[model samples]
Target: MGRKSNQQFVQIPLAKLKERIKQLCGIYGIRYVETEEANTSCASYLDGDSLPKYGEKPDGWKASGKRIKRGLYRSKDGSLINSDLNGSSNILRKVARNLGIDLSRLGRRCLTSVRRIRLWATKSNLTLKNARAFTPGS
Candidate 1:
């Protein structure tokens, strides 16, 4: 006698299923249009070249083999002294200023997370002493 095979089927709720589908579509850049004509129009707008290829160096490939030079205010042990600010933070703030973003807005948007901002600040040579002095109630 042959052994019988067992199988099980599961059903998901429609709303949850739709939400999952929408997330998947967004990840894959799939546009769902209401009408057939709209779908055709959307298809024309898609860029076939935007998809990234596996194991390929992206456009504007450069190989200088140089590490990003750290800014002043970093200690010999790679910790920030009391005076260093992250190089990238300075650059971002400069760009934001050039683009006419308010200083308060730039401050808010430039460093969203304290941990990451602190790390960047330390890495860029913004020392703990300087950071505390600049920040109120540090």
Candidate 2:
């Protein structure tokens, strides 16, 4: 998260990656629509924050949750969830809004219980400490 140069380098290939995704979607007859993810990374999905566009946020707008540290987001109730997961949920919420899908039933348990699958060189190497290291908190 501290590597600005690495982020810039990654951005260089993003356009190409988008093009490839578009091509693949077209081939597979999958609908693809690129949506603007302005405040997705900052807004709290659990708190139902009004996710606005890049410059459309109201004055003094603030999320009920925030990224407390790298790869972690702290919710309004002091619960910590993966930052990427929170952003991803916000993105899905945006898409659902556009599609008029009802996600009102989705709750904290659904998000908190999500398990991340890791690929280790060997199964024995996946110790409890190492496994829990990447979870909500260390």
Candidate 3:
């Protein structure tokens, strides 16, 4: 029985994940859109390939390995939603500043508690839906 339950829990359907993504974006007051149809590349180099030019990693050089599978979350206020940083660090910082929530304790922290951010969101009235399904640090 435990094995069966584990097997069932091992995979969450992509549809459910997408729905969760939308819910999460709604909480952040951001537009959630998966632009799978768009064939675009983010590039800076002339050859359209960004690599280690000097045989070493440059400043802020971090490899996420394969590109993170994330949905596009945009806000009119220009907030960003990054999966690597626990949803949206940009929004959190902005909200914290506005609400005077001291986050210095979490130095260079990307991931933040959902409760904290949710409280901030609630205070700002970003969404009307009751946020009960979100867990901490989601």
Per-residue alpha-carbon lDDT of candidate 1 for residues 1-138, written as tens digits (9 for 90 to 100): 333432344566977877787888889997432211111111111111121233454676432221234322332334332222232344334344345544443232333233344322344465765677899776
TM for candidate 3 is: 0.23
Candidate 2 lDDT, tens digit per residue, 45-127? 88889889878999999988989898888889888877887887788788885666576656675566566533233555667
lDDT of 3 by residue, 14-64 (tens): 999999999999999976655331112121111112344334546775432
Leading candidate by lDDT:
2
By lDDT, the better pick of 2 and 3 is 2
In candidate 3, list every pair of residues with a backbone clash: none
**How high is the lDDT of residue 2 in model 2?**
69
What local lDDT score does residue 124 receive in model 1, on the 0 to 100 scale? 40
Which residue pairs collide in model 2, if any?
none
Pick the winner on TM-score between candidates 1 and 3: 3
Candidate 2: stretches off by over 4 Å:
1-11, 99-105, 113-138
Using TM-score as the measure, which candidate wins? 2
Better of 1 and 2 by lDDT: 2
